[model samples]
Target: MTTAPVQKSSYDRYPTVPLPAGESVITGAAAWHRVRDLAYERAEDRPPLIVVDTYPGVDLPELTRQLAEAWPTAVIIDVEQEAAKPIEEIDARIADNLTDDRVFGVMSHLRLNAFYDQERLAALAERLADRTAATVLIGWGAALTATRPDALVLVDLARWEIQQRQRAGAPNWRSANGAEDNLRKYKRGFFVEWRVADRHKRDLFAKIDFLLDGNAIGHSSGVVRGPGMITGDAFRGALAAAVNAPLRVVPFFDPGVWGGHWMQDKLGLDTETPNYAWCFDCVPEENSLLLSDGDHAVEIPALDLVLTQPRGLLGAKTYARFGAEFPIRFDFLDTVGGGNLSLQVHPLTDYITDTFGMHYTQDESYYLLDADEDAVVYLGLKSGIDPDAMIADLRAAQQADHPFDTEKYVNAFPARKHDHFSIPAGTVHCSGANSMVLEISATPFIFTFKLWDWGRVGLDGVPRPVHVDHGAANIQWDRDTEWVTEHLLQGPEELSRDGDVIEERTGLHELEFIEVRRHWFENHADHDTDGTVNVLNLVEGDEVEVISPTGAFAPLRIHYAETFIIPAAVGPYRIRRTENSQSTRFATVKAYVRGTTRTDQEGPALAAGNKGVRS
Candidate 1:
């Protein structure tokens, strides 16, 4: 007899798994209790399993002491106070959680370490499964399976707790970014939406709803998560490994097909499709759908979290989990099926501060998601054409191509799949025609500098304004134009890498909130975290799965060529491969890396690989 297909993506089997819905936040203390309690409830008796982390933080012991007063006693094992944060600690946490070969178990407050692995949570699940064989497992935060894998009980406490606490002491925009005058407009909170049904609180469907814009799913979200908080976990075990331990992933996002509208022919440019679905705009429930907003996304860095260190390469995170002063947002885009993007420019940190009296950090880059072998992008100006020449022509109502001095202009050549040129602040650039790009940038939400818009109109069907004058002044004239064109003019190096299935151009420029790189995976790499969860992104991959510490993995097929974040705060994880067939390249951005220079020093050169690469 033929059997019916099994239903997936739900937790009906594990009725007790408390998954929150919508905007409500959940904290770590509540998360720990949920897991520990579930572990006990699922116990089958042999010397009940006792789970723990590498170095439970200050609050964990207090929580445990509180838990013990009301629950059963268990063994305590400390990995070491100073263990390397993400890598070493995660492995150890898993080993200590399992019961003896034959014993039933109740793991309490297990914390795992986290890292920047693209597939953080997947690794967490696998490790957890390996160590313990409990019938049901309890988990909290990001990256755990919906169902209990062993004696583990998990609840996604990250989103809820994060947004819940993000509103502490926000910036006095008046003084923070120097945008004193523009400070009049402030978002109460990025993801706070109206018309939300409160009863839909624990529904994953509900959460995803927040991230979609009816038709498309991207619209740039923003918020400041603040200095002390971090995303609860990356690898599943990592959360259990570093409970109360500090960690952070500057908030960023993954985009998907959603709402967007582009008016074709209006700009006098060719059109592939009149209406593009640049989905990463203003949607909601971005965490579940795994969608991200574009360069416009506002992510806050956590203060206590471990980040790449030049020591202070980025500003502290101030949004969810530890909620901060500004509004936080999450969104993404739809490249192939995405909507039209402008060929424009952004002001440098200085200009945004000087001219506009604001801080509009340089969140720029040249992203080529797809190429037809003949695609060319106008990056910079012709070698000798005066800046005023272009400006004067535009002001005199000259056609764009005329005064552009095509000879002085350098063509960004051989556009290939996944080729990215870093364009730091004060650079003149665009996303080029055809390719859809995932633009992960900084947190200030104002667009001051602009260039010719090719004469297109906004979604409302009116002509969009062009800022040629501001553009001229904003483009960094001192940058070596040749160096940028040579490396980014496009060729084989921009197409493939050793053993890489994905080809990409990265290391363009650096910023306080984000780090962009390009890579291709020949075979999926195993990235498990100790406990904190990570946002696993697939800029071009088709499928991936994150294995938890216990070996239970969550599989995803990213056919849309979008990015996804993986959160595995309780354990380790691994990303399974989708293809070994050939090359696929994509950019990897580390959000909120920390600002290299402060108000005190001259801004150091953008990290590397970015800035003024385009004309």
Candidate 2:
């Protein structure tokens, strides 16, 4: 199943480049040096061609002009000027109803066939490549056909920055948000196509010459050279020898109807927004990792790490199964002091593929982070459930704005701190009010079919749409109260214990592609990756430090309620609790790909030793 790039070559060996101490952001002079040095190395008759890859809102023309000033002999060409068709023509090519997620989801993945001609664009690059002394093509996909450049500068920007800049009437070239028409405004509000397209761009990291972080002004937040292909022990050495510490991908926050104030108060986040509903803690698809090379901290999309070192990050067997795609995700779903999350269910694997063009289903488990006394998790259906009756009731609740007897149809369980409730595809579930949930799930993040929303409007004061039919089709009618109670209420089974360090494994369902293990300890615990990526959270600790085998990498300091990853590349590591607590014990939940299969006469068993490995 793994389609990851193979056939090892010299490209796989990346040597560590040391940077000056106490410096973090790359200055304009430094950025100029990278390009100038590359050109000097080339020593060609024709000026070295440079490609600057930037996002929609970046001031790439300004950056190109700066480069031209730095190198008097260089020529700057903004690729937008050479577009095959007018910008207006491309803007008009967008599909109608861009506000609709379903519409945008499909259109985003499709080729830009409706807008521009790739062949014509390639021809334009070919022409421009020969015209200038040092041809500098600067734009999104500007150098699509211009073979390898003497230097490639990738400027990364965050989604929030793009949206904020767009709203502020900044100079952004995104055609969808260019004009002031009703359709354009509608498109601007729900533009996530860039988020998907950016994932495709990250795969080309091996081709990048210099990575410039543009999260701040001057595009000088940091810089990093292109990473070499990662494999085996070399991968471990790179991670252990990381310039700063174990990586913590930048987290993204979004508001929802069921958002709460916990994040605002605890994390000291801005309270001006409505509330923070979800924190994308470590989702590579939308998150970025900061590689601090001592002098500057370069921010690259998290997915690039997995792509560059799939076998090293995800182990050989797991990489073979899923390729470079990181199978597990750790995120926060906060409903504390807020409304209940919409009663939702994700589609089956086949259903997701057929409906959303996604590869897999969203099988998830909610590990309660914190909850109020009355908090509850609505899961599965009650005994003697009638599918037709439930559908009719849900329809009435959405259409007529009449609330249904939710408990009468769905089973509710008291959600306490650390309670784990499995919500695999087709299993109806939702986190009720006053609860902070650490949602661990598969990579397909947004296939939720909301059947009910407690008969309330969205935070925007608009009636949220419901997918009654979609929910009905995907609902697993067989997962009644009895099945849910017996199979979904995941409890820990002791794996191994050495003195005060106890390891327990849970979530042994056959439907899961990954396994969960909790490490509770007083001092420190050593664990092996077993050739699989490990995603973990300090759910019950004040703080902890993760140390690599050689201690070359700085120990990563993780705070309470923080999530981090130990790539498969970092083979063996130790997690030590750094702060003393009243309970004298801290707990961390670790998730990874299942190395061994477990199956009985009935199916996979959830008992101790039924699956494998104690520690």
Top-lDDT candidate index: 2
Q: Which candidate number maximizes TM-score?
A: 2
Give the lowest summed-lDDT range of ten residues in model 2.
8-17
Model 1, span 72-111: residue lDDT tens: 3443222222122352443344334322221111122322
* Cand. 2 TM to true fold: 0.81
Error of 1 at 286 (Å): 8.4
> 296 in model 1: Cα distance from truth in Å?
30
Write the residue-wise lDDT of candidate 2 on 469-491 in tens digits: 88899999998988887777645
Model 2, C-alpha of 82: deviation from truth (Å): 1.3
| lDDT per model vs. reference | 0.34, 0.66
For candidate 2, the lDDT comes to 0.66
